[model samples]
Target: MRKNRLKLGLFIPPFHPLYENPTLCIERDLQITQFADEIGMSEIWFGEHHSGGYEIIMSPELMVAAAAERTKSIKLGTGVITLPYHNPLMTANRLCQLDHQTRGRLLFGGGPGLLTADAHMLGLDARESRDKLDEGISVISRLLAGEWVTEKTSWYDLNDAHCHLLPYNGPGSLPIGVASAFSPSGGTLAAKYDTAMLCLAATSPDGYDALAGNWKIACDTAEKYGRTMNPAVLRCATDMHIAETRDEAMDQARKGFEVTQRYFANQTAHVANEGMDVTLEDLIERGEAVVGTPDDAVAQIRRLEEKVPDFGTLLLLDKNWATFENKKRSLEMMMRYVLPEINGDNVSRQKSFDWQGEHAEEYFKTFQQAAQRAFEKHAAQTEADK
Candidate 1:
């Protein structure tokens, strides 16, 4: 077999395990992330949320900075940062500062703010989200590019604006990833800007199929604009729980997904009429969440690979706010017992390390997603029997 070279990362969400003590939350998060760095993991990516339904960490930059200082190798990312919530100038400057602070170990993740709570907390309405995201990104992209630009609209205004943001190792370098649950618009932007696409995989291959459509449209859009698109830059996230036995795995996931379902249910109350059909737990049992022992999870993942061969990037971990110990145990199990088996890639580590490798972020989040990419590539290589 050819070398798989797949990457795996622990998805560190802000939501605490459902049973964690509030006082020890910060300490626990630090401990887990540091351990992930020490455990020879590729990256540690977290998302942004306001009003604190689960975890207290909301500022992706602040968290990335703190993670950068503590760990020498593991890549830190916004996992995602909602672009629409802040003044473009300030958000762009801050992200650029983080890039410099981490010496270029930063990923620019573009996502519109989700819940009404997050928008409300920012003193905005969700109805204006798409427009806000586009405007903010327009300004941020130029600001990072050494462009003296201006944007004047009824919504936001910038006059003769310029920003001094240092690019990583080179004069112009920073890998940006765009997060989209199901919007073709994000996929279009990803290709247009040469950024990667992130899809939440906590649901099903059905969700994978849905996101894949966006990726396709993105490429089509790029082609329409006389631009080239590379299918290799795909990214996705999976809600996965691994354990010693199938029953044990299901039990762990039951608790975690229950909490997640409730949290989102409460958050999506006013928006319930949006026709959100499936519960988070339903996404779990339907081969989407991958809740089971290693063998079972592997089978489910392989099926997904057969179906969507170009998918890459995935979030395999979730918040450990309430059940810190349980979550930690699960993470350890995943690292030791589950991950190596699925991708079965060669992993090298030191009690401490000198290099974290170049594609650390991709390697971490794109392991299973890579399977789809691989299956697609592999099948293409083999000639069909006439």
Candidate 2:
């Protein structure tokens, strides 16, 4: 099989236990981002959620800014900022400022708010959220590009509105990615706008299965719109937990696995509904979650790469699904072991073994001499005893 080389990232929804203090959760999240940077992770994505008690972060931009200030080199992104929840002008300006703050290390992800109750609380109809997202993205794109946006959408309006502080990366410097699950809308929008696709549900079997078709749709649509799409722009994310050994990984996952399921059940019915009836084995079999050692993680990633063929980044979904210590160890192992193996770092290690093989005869001669001396000494001792 061909080696699959890919960049690694974290999609920290920053999920915490409802019983745990939110402040502590947020602090740990910051520390994890720093850890990821230190370990050579290419990027870190923060999720924005409003209504979920566990997904307590109201703003990913703030989190990204906080993370960026604490780390260097690791690109920061919004797993998504629910476009429908904020006006385009505000969102654009904040992101542009973040781009500058992070020194052009910002990846902008925009999508419709996922929670129905969140939209409802904001006086937006559940049905209008997607439409609002589409419109908001369109407007935000213009504003970010230093264009004065003047338009009236049902959910929001912008008249002569423009962001004075454009992206530090330059005009159109913002790399916009649209979040999608099993739907084609994300691909369609990405193609039309020449943006990226954030396959948020890439871990799910249904999501994994849709990848090839989604890429096709995005490419064809991009060609039709006289634009070019890069396959590397596609980011596929999956849930994962790795330990020193497969048994340890599975046991640790089992410890807090049900709590995660319950969180999904109450806060994200769409995702929870699919797994509520299945066992952990079933979920792993379906490519919905990965809980094992580094070897298993490598195998699962290869499986995903084979399915998508050219997908770029593998984002590990961050949840409080294991003990905090185990979670840190898992990511460290990924960086130290799995990532290197996948990226062919082991080839360098193999060179030393090859050198040893080349000098095998010399090594064997030395070993034989040492053994003969030891045997002779033992014989002398035995003779003395006699």
Best by TM-score: 2
Which clashing pairs does model 2 show?
none
Error of 2 at 8 (Å): 0.6
The list of candidate 2 runs beyond 4 A from truth reads 1-4, 271-277, 348-356, 359-386
lDDT at position 295, candidate 2: 89
What is the number of residue pairs that collide in model 1?
24
Instruction: Give one digit per residue, the lDDT tens place, for model 1 in 1-386.
Output: 11343355666666664466755776666677888777767666777877645746688788888888888787788867788766777777787788888888777777777667778876877888866666666677777777777778656688877766556654347667776666576777776666777665424554666755776788887888788665445555666666777677666656556565555555565225433455544555566666666676556555545534534444565644225566666667666765665564434443124354566676777886888889988787775632
TM-score of 1: 0.78
Minimum summed lDDT over a 10-residue window in model 2 is located at 267-276
For candidate 1, what is the lDDT? Answer: 0.66
C-alpha RMSD of candidate 2: 6.1
Which one wins on lDDT? 2
lDDT by residue for model 2 (59-112), tens: 999999899889989999998999888878999999999999999999999988
> Which sections of candidate 1 miss by over 4 Å?
1-4, 17-20, 201-206, 269-282, 321-326, 336-386
